[model samples]
Target chain A: MINRRDFMKLSAVGGGAVFLSGLSQITQAAAAYDDFYFVQLSDSHWGYQGPANPEANNTLRKAVETVNGLELQPDFIMFTGDLTHTTDDPKERRKRLTEFRDIVSDLKVKNVHFIPGEHDASLDNGAAFKEFFGETHYSFDHKGVHFVTLDNVSDPGASIGEAQLAWLAADLAKQARDARIVVFTHRPLFDLVPKWDWATRDGAKVVQILMEYPNVTVFYGHIHQENHHMTGHIAHHSAKSLVFPLPAPGSQDKRTPLPWNPAAPFSGLGFREVEAEDKPFQLKITEFPVTRA
Target chain B: MDLQISKGWKIGTACLAILALVSIGAAHSAAPKTGKERVVKVVAKRFIYTPNEIILKAGVPARLEFTSLDFVHGFKVPDLDIRVDLPPGKVTTVHLTPQKAGVYDFLCDNFCGVGHEEMSGKIIVKD
Candidate 1:
């Protein structure tokens, strides 16, 4: 049965929302392109070594290759988090950041924004992540659009908390009502399901802050597989992994973090690119395969 | 399908994949002993599980040699209902025996983030 959320998602994509779908659709702007394009690369579990994601088996190495291959230069790059894996280990954590740094070092692009998923912050509530990366939740402006990168995960109980909400309200308040806004995070701001590590605890507060914005889009990583849902004018999207794919949300009882299938090499690992035109920017998504060189 | 688990794997791993914080608090009452009977070693890294799917019979014990090359990860089988954390650089192992005949899904329960949800495979049990 087609669910309402699925239906909304269908409307977003099939209902004619994605400006361009792939590399083949690249076209020159006729008039002033208010459309600014950006790349969203999620779930790149660097440091994970397995046959499933051998292309990124070295973590740092594959990311460089993937980002370098963007057909067109994006306005910026947003990695929604999961910068590392696990806790209780410093060497591995350092390896994760070091590799991330290595990839960033080789990058010829500018302004790469990041957010922490539950994993990177899981060990010590993202103390390690803060040490390496900057603030967990922050917002910025690009062109005529407002971009909010939130910290919805990294807590023990999956709560968005209070401090971040205060920051969000102040940030969004600074933007014009007609200005376009895009919020990026690792976890969904809406409740997909609380019991299964989906929904955000204080996600509602974040939503309230964005309610004033006419054009709002929420992009999240985590969940692995592709998922999209829209509430009011807010659209939530989850990107595919550069590693493996998981079952739909709430599919099993802690029965996820599924393994990779050699038969399905780079099956679910892909990328999402969005171009915004007319200030807010027109968006596009391309699912490029993981190159295993 | 919805993404909830009553919770479960075959093989494979990820970089920022699964944050496997194994809180196996209260003894693993059934922690299989490292015995000399039947043991199987599994190499988990990247995202693909070697030997894709495995068919095992009941009463047969198998040891998993899981190793995480990139970061840390977890190995879980739903029908079998077992979870083991595979930290980077270490060859971790676990033992299990299939109790029924069916296709079971194994997933990374550690929320390795992003691809963490989809990082999984399957286990087939044959009578």
Candidate 2:
């Protein structure tokens, strides 16, 4: 009963399993493991209180609970941005940021990186966000992969200014041309849709700098939707928001928050989990929606 | 005697009429003049401003009335020093007199969602 096609499929599956097993063994052998995984949670909007999210107060808590309950522990969690909804009062802003930090502290993962969204940075040029999160933009290395977190939100006009670009250039220059690079920011680095303010003013320059690298990937979370784009060989992936979902670019005359359906309370709210292997271009990303337990 | 009384009354009447006319003229002069007023209606939703692009004539005063279709949003033209907070179901008005002829970017200062950064528009002033 096994035809040529069936035999070929079976062989392919068996080979894949063996290859995966060997990869796992290699991953386990490394004491200084190069392969790892991380979670990206963005736009928690911790202090948001409205009908759009009747469960706004509990969303972040639930997200933390969900992360804690995951079967596989993430090496770290990077919150893309919008940790808290903006407030005019500095005291309230600080309080919100503190509350967000305190809540996220419940996550089993100890290493959490944060970047600011326009909400967190636009008010006072990120003075409060910087006070709470420290260094709006910076870079670090993990397991041979270079991770750069840029602060596109801290500037008054959603831009990655000259200084940051210079810093990025200098930082990238030190790495090998073939080094695996992952850039994380809150806003899209390309002109996705200028009318909706989705485009970063100076993102083109940043992309230009990134194009120099042989391997690069960008993960951001301002659009509140799952979107994939590419600039040259670099791939740009946008994650969903932890709070609410936004309309697609230019879908409506105005970009408005999609109403939360009471029936399906957590319809469009979720976080992204990314797994990176030691090999270049071996990143597996999955988006998980928040569901009631 | 009749002639003297009639003449005095006539003079008094004439003086009263003159005073009334002068008061009416003064009131007319003191009244404020109405200038041409332009009103621009803007609806702010989640992440985009309605009528994202606007054109105005320089030296002309304008009233921008902003209303949020949903959520609390903000409208700010940093160059024009215009900032207004728009609560859902409420109308906020911003008065602007553009003296310069150029393009001014107006953005939503309040964070509505992931698309908050993209919620901006342009105000073009023509000479």
Candidate 3:
């Protein structure tokens, strides 16, 4: 059953007919499903040093602490992208990645999935990301849900491209129409704002492939703010960055990082928890602030 | 005899004037200001460069003043060996004179983020 809090949150975000339909399906499938949960951490931006986030160093540590403290253990953890701040030197990049890996290794969950943010993959065109995280784009199945992680950021031009698109099409062909699909990528597939560099160059093509599926949800990072959008029946949700926040689209003249306030540490930064159930298929998302203001 | 001498003098004077004018023309052609240094203000953010596409006359000198709106970014035009490191909130200037008319690609050599590789622009030099 849909709770009032979930309804309020969904309504506030303009969760349209598709979301409502999904909710109804979940309600009907309640008896046939087993519950499981996962955590999503995005834009940790490790190795980032600046006043924008005074606690930048501790940001990932704090997220780890929070995840460990969860009363209900998460089945896994997925980091959306922007794992590091980015550096030109190869040695430095490796160092940052190693440090980030070491820190996140402490996570209680063993099944952790990582996708490269532009900062991590754009420099060497996914070489570093692949070296460290294995495949840049791949799929996995967990509890009846098919999760597809794509490498959009590695292209430098921010495109899923032909090969990856073909892979996606072929991969989707194997799944039944009733299968629940969750897509993960670094950038928004639709144009959020071209001027602000929020839109992926060839994202429309990727969307076309995803449209064939009835139950498809896309989660992405890069905008560094919690946002929701819809294309056809598909719902797109952008998670908040673990490090710091950026200005809302066109909120300012420029898409600069939001200045941090010393008075309020880790105010607008946090991670998301997603609870999923089988049978009718239900996924409920909850966002937690790092520090309560 | 007097008329012939005057004619010769007149010709010599005219030749000297012609030489003076030719030298001045040569000097003007040699120092023709291609166009006042084309100054462009570029703001570098996470993974993209603003004013990414730059157009300049072939012979014109260009000055790009780059300021990072976000992180530290490196502006590099390898063809011209023009590179500048842009630190947040600081303006870095790069000077270039396009000697040839061609399209030159510039990119952020410093990795800014996931989009850094795609963070590039074209410098179109027109004759």
Interface RMSD of 2: 6.1
Q: How well docked is model 3, in DockQ terms? A: 0.10
Model 1 chain B, poorest ten-residue lDDT window?
B17-26
Q: What would the per-residue lDDT of candidate 1 be over residues A138-184, giving only the tens digit for each residue?
A: 88877666788888776644567787778788887776565567789
lDDT of 2 by residue, A68-168 (tens): 87666778899999899877678988999999999998999999999998878876788998898899999998876789999988765676899999999
Q: Estimate each model's TM-score.
A: 0.61, 0.67, 0.68
Q: For each candidate, what is chain B's TM-score? A: 0.61, 0.70, 0.69
Q: How high is the lDDT of residue A231 in model 3?
A: 93
CA displacement after TM-score superposition, residue A205 of candidate 2 (Å): 0.6
Model 3 — TM-score against the truth? 0.68
Number of colliding residue pairs in each model = 73, 2, 8
Say which prediction, candidate 1 or candidate 2, comes out ahead on TM-score. Answer: 2
lDDT of 3 at A84: 88
Q: Which stretches in model 3 have alpha-carbon errors above 4 Å? A: A1-33, A278-280, A291-293, B1-127
Top candidate when judged by DockQ against the true structure? 3
